[model samples]
Target: MMAFFEKLERKFGRYAIRNLMMYLTALYAVGFVISLVNIQIYYEYMSLDVAKILSGQVWRLITWIMYVPEQNVLFAAIMLVLYYSLGTNLERVWGSFRFNVYMFMGYIFLIIGAFILYAVYGEAASVFLLTPDSLNMSIFLAFALTYPDMTFYLYFVLPIKAKYLAFVYLLIEVYSFIIGGVITKVSIGLSLLNFVIFYLMTRNWNRISPKNVVRQVKFKKAVKMRPAGEPIHRCAVCGRTEKDDDTLEFRYCSKCKGNLEYCSDHLYTHTHVE
Candidate 1:
């Protein structure tokens, strides 16, 4: 799956939207304003009502994302900021295309779940209850997976690790699934399917291991011990240094003049210097 994502990035990464989180944040802001003006109006028109959708209100499919989770103004503000931080950091870690794929796959899973509920229960289904909570949970789960040791102040008081918080939330979700209505069960299962799939695919547990952490710390110290003003080997074309982008290999180009180096990206395609 990661190899498939790599292939996708090579082919389609250029077209991905940068800072996509900002747009998603903006939508939440819009939803907040809409809620202030007339909450019922937006919920009636925009909530993920499959019955209404089948009745030709197709816009609900996309517009339902604008439904912001209810919270006090201060809490909402804090939550939005936290979500923005999580989302942008994930984007930086995963790159634009892969992050986009992760988010959109979550959305697709939710949609499919809703449709399945509608088919099973007909008009009795209330899958629209899922919405923004499940979506937001997925984002949080991804952040916890990526930065497990990162600390947050619980209620601006006690410091707690993100992984612990995520575990608590996961437990709550499992409990909800066991006791909740059919809609809730479906929502929890289908909405978090993205996180489950992503965790399985990336398998980044080794990155958070104590051994890996010590190894990385030692490597950084070694790099820092190097003499000041020493030139680090970097790709002449892309300007990526091994220190910054360890995934890339830099090689001196014998075919090029003036001690030119190139990374794997430009090693072969770059014009040879005379």
Candidate 2:
């Protein structure tokens, strides 16, 4: 999967927005203001309402991303700022392309999860799990897991290791899923799935870093160059070289003289040239 992800990064990396979280944070601010004016306005039009989407209100698909988890204006401001910091740090560590993929993966999953919720409950699953809060929390979780020992000042006073807080959050989500209603269960499930995928991606952050990828490419080229000198094995019967097809296995024939060899395809059938 990392190899496939790298192929995508090479093809599409340049198009990724640098400091993408800044833009997202700005959008979150906009959402916060809009909510202050009228919280119901977003739900009425911008929510990912499948019924509305099928009815041609397709803009909801993209617009629903603006929803922030915080209802209080002050809390929203603080949360946005916190996420902006964590997001920029992640981008610095993983590079913009990787960070972009991480964030967009969450969005895509949220959209898909919204559809699943709709299918399960139709209109009854009104509790939305598509808020930017869940996405940001996923980012924080990734960051914490990546830098487990890193310290965070909880409530701007108590200092604690990020891993501990992440553990607590994980427990809370698990408990919520176990005890919450249908809507809460679905919401938490979506959020956990998004984080799980991202956690897999960032398990070995160094492997995906730009520097590491460049090193791997250089090493691959050097190794390939060494193998270009001459063929190590060749078929005595069909004269097929190892260069022709790597999957073909070659072995020396005991019946043949002068160290003759044959590829797997012709090995058993070839006559001995003694």
> Which of the numbered candidates is closest to the native, going by highest TM-score?
1
Off by over 4 Å in 1: 126-128, 204-274
Per-residue accuracy of model 2 over 169-265 as CA lDDT, tens digit each: 8898788889987656666677778778766753545456676667657655755776556776778878888689765566555446565667755
Local distance difference test values of all predictions, in order: 0.77, 0.75
Query: What's model 2's overall lDDT?
Result: 0.75
Residue 177 in candidate 1, Cα distance off native in Å = 1.3
Query: Candidate 2: how many backbone clashes?
Result: 0
Clashing pairs in 2: none
RMSD of 2: 15.8
Candidate closest to the true structure, highest lDDT: 1
Candidate 1, 1-274: lDDT as tens digits: 5456556778998988899899988988888888878888676898888888899999988888887767468877887899999999888766787678788888888888888888888887754445867778889888887667778899899999889999999999999989988778777887777888876775535445676667657656866988986546678887888677654556555546675777655753467799
